[model samples]
Target chain A: MTLTTLPPPHHEPVAPHDLRARVTDVLLRFIDDQDQILRDVDPELSTMTTALREFVLSSGKRLRSTFCYWGWRGAGGAPDDEGILVAASALELLQGCALIHDDVMDSSDTRRGLPTMHRRFARWHRLGDLHGSPEEFGTSVAILLGDLCLSWCAQMFDGCGLSEAAISRAKPAFHQMHTELMAGQYLDLLGPARGGGSSERARLIIDYKTARYTVGRPLELGALLADGGPELRARYAAYARPLGEAFQLRDDVLGVFGDTERTGKPAGDDLRAGKHTVMMDLTRSRATAAQRAVLDALFGNPDLDRDGIGKIQDIIRETGALASVNALIEEHRTAALSHLTDSLLETETQATLTELAITVTNRDY
Target chain B: MTLTTLPPPHHEPVAPHDLRARVTDVLLRFIDDQDQILRDVDPELSTMTTALREFVLSSGKRLRSTFCYWGWRGAGGAPDDEGILVAASALELLQGCALIHDDVMDSSDTRRGLPTMHRRFARWHRLGDLHGSPEEFGTSVAILLGDLCLSWCAQMFDGCGLSEAAISRAKPAFHQMHTELMAGQYLDLLGPARGGGSSERARLIIDYKTARYTVGRPLELGALLADGGPELRARYAAYARPLGEAFQLRDDVLGVFGDTERTGKPAGDDLRAGKHTVMMDLTRSRATAAQRAVLDALFGNPDLDRDGIGKIQDIIRETGALASVNALIEEHRTAALSHLTDSLLETETQATLTELAITVTNRDY
Candidate 1:
């Protein structure tokens, strides 16, 4: 079914106080309950479970969970705690698994102002006087623990109490999201390794990895599980797609320029790690020979010290690449807003989603 | 559901021959098909995928798939190629995911006379003059690749055309096996690191990690999917449990003494790597102070030369640990055979399973 086109917005302000608070409360409590269930699986596993739960449930905007909740709500389903919470919790578990594994893959020592799970396990190994190499021991534990979390995510999703038809319909979309995300990740990894790829390739990776899976699928999954017909699904995707891209573009900007305290990461981590992001592509495409040489030397170099990072950041700004990327972010944000206006949605739901989209693009964290 | 008991095995071996041939043929073909799918995911990814698939699939006995097929046939279902092949393929996929990830975790450089996936990826990174640390790039690629394999396994299982009820019933057992296997792996990792866990702990890890999940669960899942009633289920478990233990016990013995060509590994690789196996535990528990001193110097030391491994091996044999572990393997095998006789299974099914169990314990590979 096709989504109905929405008329231009009337000059009415849509306040978001109630929906925001309700979504936050549901998400936080649901995550806590899931953490409890994870721990309950084996009390002796408390150390690993507790650490993972804390990392996942730590303060964040919970944007994906919010999208899911509103998507379900927008589909004409009453926001029952069980369904919303379970869906939200499952998403959070998946996020946890991804983040933990991602940190290991990236070799990032700290996350959320704490040692990453692998590093923490490594410390434990050192303290325990483990017989083997501490680093190897740490990695082994972390890998197994992440697999546990991934397994738990599937199990929890399966047990979400949604009807069989709802689950069956949503399953393909869920699998697609997973496959796309991994493919996107593969592109990201291959980009820098190959030393060069087109701007189109970089943009596609960003869209699939961050835009669609992070926002589009979660929103669609919620609507699907709520038994929304095809029209609502189409409408939600219309709103979610560009908004998700804008959100990731903003994140790409932050990864290079945001404050360490706010981002919970070392400043210019993306640049130093040589991540082949959209912003990087914008800079590279427009760079002079001397600037390109500098970029090659600094970006993706594990040996890049703080001064090297600072110089690279300065070069990025000087090349006008940062400004252009910022402009692109705004372009996507405006386009997303236009799509939202052109979709069929209830007045209240529209307002809530619009506010969320704005927050996503503007948020510092 | 409790499994039924099997009837006494007659001296006939004819029933097992056809089942083994069919199961092996289907399993190898499935592995080839999956490798093709992996290559199709991205042609660029073929180099690594082909190497991994070949290393894992070549000349290997499809033991787990065999158990699954036998379990299905023993459930009193008419022997059918389609159902058996699908279930066996699913098991093979699961095994592939486990091995790929496990090799990375163990930091092994080779598998089946070929470079491990991670190691191969590392070699590619170096050869291509990739921009990042070769080791890190290798690991990142391997991690993402393994995750892809895992997700594909789930998707393939979901598409296996099993009835919803059957799929649902089999899922818990599938999940449970994965969880137990990971937990057991953790215990094994932790045991070696800690170096002071009780012998019982080591044995428990073996039973759960290698014995139950590797053999018991695969067999049970096959039976359940084939519509095995409680009686048949319990009977299969009774036959599988001890037989599975014997399989692992034999592996422990082989780890220390088996030929490199036959085992597809270097002789005393486990000793050199300082694996905390049941035999190791038994040796430690019985060692005198002088013997303990020798082990302490050699065990888990990265500096261990060829002579050190040989010395450790000699000590293990001298302490009678080898003989005792071998004796335990025989005992478990005998118990499995006795249980098979005591079970109330169909005569034909019993004969097939009995021969399979014996082959597992006696096989050199």
Candidate 2:
């Protein structure tokens, strides 16, 4: 079943880079506007806008923006409409909110190759000799900052230059996306403890947390803005879901196998953390009795060292877990791409989306 | 300057209580709707909805909604428009977002006299024997829940059954409230660390964090929905800001002097937290060098004992800080009530607003 549903990432980088650059500019302008509004309240409050600007503009793949843009393009949104670009940029704020909270949830110290917001705030507490536990203070500041991002996401979306009709069309999808994303985050927290680890359960999480959020809804948002009807939305979902899971699976694979320098964290970090990923469940289902014992001993061990990591890596490879995951990736990729066949989307936008699928699934860094 | 601008809460509870009950019912229905939506996504995610319902419905004064409902009434809003009630209920969700984030920021273990959301989530981790740090897990869950509330606040406001014109009128105020509240939170955080602790700085924090957020904008939102003109909005703000600050000042007083059973926390909780407010700044300014030395040693001490709290309390009283704060509250009350004198508000709604001012400032719990 995995064989037919997934496919490998296309190897080379896809270059539809201008739109991404444009989306960044849109975000910067919005932040600058906010800077003025906040400054009027008090000069000190502008620090938040500055932090928000740094968080948003410093780095991002702008994948959702591109997906949203292309979705609009596919639905005959005017390529020259700056309004769509402004509207599409709102997705980044939404993503930023998610990442800020996700890092806090995971107790992650870094993101985008920089200290995560909470870590930075924690450091401030120590350096400033502030009155509170640095960790608690840091967590608090990050939580507030994340909240600011969530609030600003809605502000940006509502204030972005979309026509009333376009906004009306997009509103339900946007609202549903947020509700789903939070629900998905809750479900993810439930996963490791609930301990199903079955591929079916994994797929369900992926659908809510990644696939629909990262791709399907965004694409539908674009289509909705341009008045794309039911059939078009259905097609977008068909193409989005498998590809999104493929993207996540690739991240999981790279977490174990990719070079530490490239992935920005240690190889097998996920193994030490024992992240409730489906790939591992598949491995557990197939592992020999001795391998199962090794897995049980090493997985999620905080003190698991390089040697333990290497051993687990070897078991994963030896057990054909790597091969099967690759098989699953290919199956999803094929399933996603198959929807593009005979699609009514504008040819250029369709091609860009196809390329995005490759870049999303295959990126090593 | 502070003494001339603030006022005391009237001692009796004014009971123009229909709007509050109506608002609660509206919140319950909204939460129920969200419950259904999340359950549709997955059974487990519905737990978030349950938690949210508990948080919102448990114990809030419904101050913002009351202010809003009366603002609408004052602006000739039909006392019967259920839509306005729904729109006003959105404030409680917005308040929910603020309280959850604020509790996390303060690292306070309780809210409305119960374990904070993070505390509750953390307890779940310990009880369920989940695999990570319970505190971290709890904080993360709380942060996500806050984001969910913030999102639903907007969604509810937008989806509330208002005509397009009313929504358009209300949107900017609603949007501004969120932006300013976050900015105020940021300013409040900066106060202790940056340490001017002057009355001016504290007042600025109050204006943004509590004054406008707690009262001003909610009224404006109601007025806007009812097409209250600029004159009416200006009058509303003039009435709101001083009354809002009086409410905050009264809270500061209660935090120090009210019964723990009534206040829902220990006496001097704000002093223990070293919360920067105009009332405290006055104490600092008037304190003798010996008293200053005592304060420097004890304020914000996380391990502050009951003896230390008593010492601080004695100083606050002796320095005449408590007297000046009450004096300021009365001044502001007079200023706020002065607006009602010539106001064109419906007599019934005017009486309600006047009574609300007394209840909000005077509440023991």
Best by lDDT: 2
lDDT of 2 by residue, B270-362 (tens): 877788878678898899999999999998776788899889888888999988888888888888988887747779878877887777775
| TM-scores, chain A, per candidate | 0.86, 0.94
Give residue A86's error in model 2 in angstroms. Answer: 1.2
Regions of model 1 farther than 4 Å from truth:
A1-44, A59-61, A288-297, A301-311, B1-56, B81-84, B288-290, B303-310
lDDT of 1 by residue, B1-365 (tens): 00012233344443345555665565456546655754555556455456545544563666677777777777765677576556666666556657767888888887777787788888988998877678887887777776665665566566667777777777778777767777677777777677777767767776777667767887788888887888777766776778777888777777766666767777666876777777888898889999999998887777777788788888888888877877787788887778667546777777767777766665553
Full-model lDDT for every candidate: 0.70, 0.81
Candidate 1, position B82, lDDT: 74
List the candidates' TM-scores in order.
0.88, 0.95
- Cα lDDT, model 2, residue A261: 61
Which candidate tops TM-score?
Answer: 2
